[model samples]
Each structure stands twice: as C-alpha cells, then as structure tokens.
Target: MIPSLRLLYWRPSAAALVRTRALLPMAEFYNHETGDGAFRLIQKSDYARALQGARVGLCLSDHEGPMRASVEYQLLDLPVVTTEAQGGRIEMMDPAHCRVVPADPRAVADAVQELAAEEIPAGAVRASVLSRLAAHRAALPGLIRPHLQAAFDDASAGVTLDDIGKVDLWRTRDAEVIRREVDAMPV
Candidate 1:
C-alpha cells in the first residue's frame, strides 16, 4: 500500500497548481478545492490532526518558507520533501532529516516515492525539529537582546532635540503653543 504523501500548504501556486493534475492519481493534493475531489483545504487548527498517520509532507514551491506546517510535520516526525526557497531562519529539515530537492514536480515525485518506499527514521525527524528548536532556543537571547535594548533606549531616552534643528519649527511651535495655551487657560 502506498503511504500517505500529503501536501500541506497555505496556498496552491506555481508547481503546486500544475502538479495537482500531474500527481493526481498518486499524491493527495490538499488545500482548498471542492466538489467530489480528494483534495480539500484543512483548517489551520486541524493541520496536525490531519497529518495523523501520514508518511510524507510535500511542499513544492520555487519559493517556499521554513513553514510552520513543515515544522509541525517534523515535530510529528514525518518526512518532508520541500524546495530550497523556504522562509524560516534555519533549515528545519536539513539534508539529514528530510529530502531537499529541486523545485520541480518530477523531483518532488521521486522524493515522495523514495520516502514512501523507505520509512523515515523517527530519530532523524525528531532530531531535526529538536535541533532547530535548540538552535533558536540558544540564540533567542542574542536575537532579542539587541532589539530590546534599542527599544528600551528609544522609549527612555527618545530622540533628543538639543539644538531642535531637525524639528519643523512650525509644527513644533504649534504643538508647544497649543499645550501652553491649554495649560495657561482657565481650568
């Protein structure tokens, strides 16, 4: 029996648009198509649930992201076949974890076929997710510290106006006059 090789994506475009018919008999194309068809859009909440008992998660895009669904699949320990154009800061499905292939339907088909024939090692899939999580976990502080400091400084110190040269005098004076007049006016 062929294992479940499902495409979990937010939108269908590019090769996905074409592969719907190309991979129709084999791949279960999911995501927003109705009327007596195997392909159907699953709600975001139900993504992980829908992936239950699935073997492969396929995403074939010229420009793909390090997607949440892909990560979820990784967390669920499912093999993935995706293009290089994924969005995440880190490659969640590294070469060790999943099949990274050319952004073409045939290549995607081959990867899916390979995954279906051979079971994806649970350790590898989990480790890929864990590795990405660990890297992000380790880097979280560094990633946030600089931005937080910049924000803190901006909030606390603000943009100083010593000479007031940068300020548009008309707008500034208008605001100042309004404030002074409001303050000086009878309560």
Candidate 2:
C-alpha cells in the first residue's frame, strides 16, 4: 500500500498525546469521532484497515510488555519510530529500517519524518522485523521468568485457574485528569 498518510499511532495516553501532537501535522488516524482536527479516534475492530495508508508506525508507549501494534506495523512492512521503551519492542526492530528514539517530541517527530520519506523496500522491512522478532521470541521466556504467572500461582495455591482469571486487571487513575490533558492539546 502506498503511504498516503504520514504516520500511524494506535495506542494513545496522556504522555503519548503530548508527543503525538508534535507529529499531528503529518499523521492520519481515527478514534471515536472526537470531532477534533488533529485526530479521529480509531476502533480496535478496524485497526488493520486504519494502518493501510500510513507511512510510519509511531510507538511511544511506556507499557511494560511487548506492544502489539508495533509488531503489526512491521509485519505490514511499515517502518517504526519507537522510544527507549520499557518493553522489548525495540528488540523486534532492525535499526537499519526502524528507529529507536528518545521520548522527546521533537526527536520522535524528526525520526518519523525521516523514516516516512525514505523509500525502503517493503520486503526488507518485513524480513528484518521477522528475524528480530523470531530471535526475541526465543529469548523472551528467560527474561520475563514467570513473573505474573508465578505471583498468581502463589496467590491461588488452592484456588481454581478460572477463579484466578476473574480480577480487576485494568483500571484508570482519574478520568477528569485524562480529559484535562486531552483538552490541553489543540484540535
């Protein structure tokens, strides 16, 4: 697919938004029809469809595990611009095609533009990402080391597996704080 759009950034958070805004002049993504000029919120159902015209994948999350969207972008032959992230997403990237950047907005924006403009071969992107991802997949088990599973196992020694699964795995800090941060950015 031709990269008609400049950037694709799927995971959004308050800190992510601060950086995302710097690249807004170039990216094209859709969310919940926020009626804002800088963005349109995307739905999970149409994520792959939304990635079609994107020139580069912007992954700036501070998530502690492997990011799914960054892998998806590479598989689709799109170059990536990622931060010095907590997760091992960087390991899946070949520096020749994808960039490992700092959290700074200006730096991320510059790297995204550079990758977007380059005419790197699609096959090369996919090949490199695949090789790295394969190697990382093998190495991952050693690094994570039964982290959450071990905790759950210890906590539920006599409890059923099904019982352990039911829990408040996800929650937010404060809705108003998030809304305020989002409002701070220009539409």
Candidate 3:
C-alpha cells in the first residue's frame, strides 16, 4: 500500500486527467470553475486552510519553477517530500526542515514516514520561509529583467511559465544562497 502523501494537484489537462483517473480511484478531484471538486476537490475558498491543515506538502512538479506552494509549506512548517527535479531552493532547509526525496512512490513513502515521526518546530520553519520569500522577491525583479528583455526583443525567446521546468530543490551549499542574499542587501 502507498503511504499518505495528501496529494494537492491543481487542474490538470484532459490527457493527464484520464491517466490519473485510471490509475487511482480519484480520492479528490478539484475544478475551481464549476466548483466540481469541493469536498472531493476542496473549496477554492478553503484551499489555503486545507494546505495549512495537511501534515505535509507533496509536490511532484516535473516542470516546476519557483514553486510558491513549496514556500507556503515551509512557512507552515510542514515537512516536504518532493522530487529533486524541483531544485536547489530547498537546499537551505535542514534534514529536519523537510525531506527532499525522489518523486517515486517508494522514496516519497520513506520521506513521509520519516517526517511524520520527527519533531518539527513550526515557528522556526515559518521564519525560514518568510526570510527566503523576502530574499527571492527582491532578487526576482533583477533576475527576471534579462529574461523579459530577451523575450521582448525576440518574441521567440519569451519566458513563459511553461518554460521553467522541474527544479532540483537541493543544488549548492544551502547556506551559500542565504549568505549571498545577506551580502547583496544594501546596508
């Protein structure tokens, strides 16, 4: 049997929908448009509360980019068990912060079990999330300017959300990103 990951997938395409429906018994299907997946899908109004209520935030995004959900999870201090494809942003998180693992079921299961058993300090986790969010927000304007200019100069080079694919939450030394961020801040 698979471990409880409390999957929170958004509206997927028809092809993806068919595949998931066939594989699993549709524990909960959500469509904010028609309010189709309310309890099963969950109410859009309560989406935030729902995310906060969960024990863990599971993101298997293969084409992820600066995942906001991941940050929210960190803010909530819920342990994460995501794929490496999500990338290095999570490197700052300690082993205790969350369990960044492979996307596979077995690996996810292991991470989930470990996090569930561990004692996580929600306050500290939330602080980390807030700090990271601020740093990322500050850097975003500069980092994205070039990409935007490139897109404007050449329509073919537009940086669409789809272009940012799955990332690896663990890349370089986690502390380095934070330290560099601190250094970059103007006194």
Per lDDT, the best of the predicted structures is 2
- Candidate 1 residue lDDT tens string, 34-110: 32444466766677777887777765555644457677777778787876674662366676547878877678878
**Considering summed lDDT, which 10 consecutive residues are worst modelled in model 2?**
164-173
* Every candidate's CA RMSD: 13.7, 10.2, 11.8
The local lDDT score (0 to 100) that residue 153 gets in candidate 3 is 57
Candidate 2 vs. true structure, TM-score: 0.55
| lDDT to native, each model | 0.62, 0.67, 0.60
In candidate 1 the C-alpha lDDT for residue 34 amounts to 34
Per-residue CA lDDT of candidate 2, range 44-139, in tens? 546677677777887887765778778888988889888888876887888888888888877887898899889897588889888886776665
Q: Using lDDT as the measure, what is the rank order of every candidate, best first?
A: 2, 1, 3
CA lDDT for candidate 1: 0.62
Against the true structure, candidate 1 reaches a TM-score of: 0.59
What does candidate 3's lDDT look like per residue over 1-187, in tens digits? 3443245566677788678767766344434333654424544456666665567767666656667677667766777777776454565454556776766878887777777777776587777767766776565545645534544555424344334333321232377864785468653
Higher TM-score: candidate 1 or 2? 1
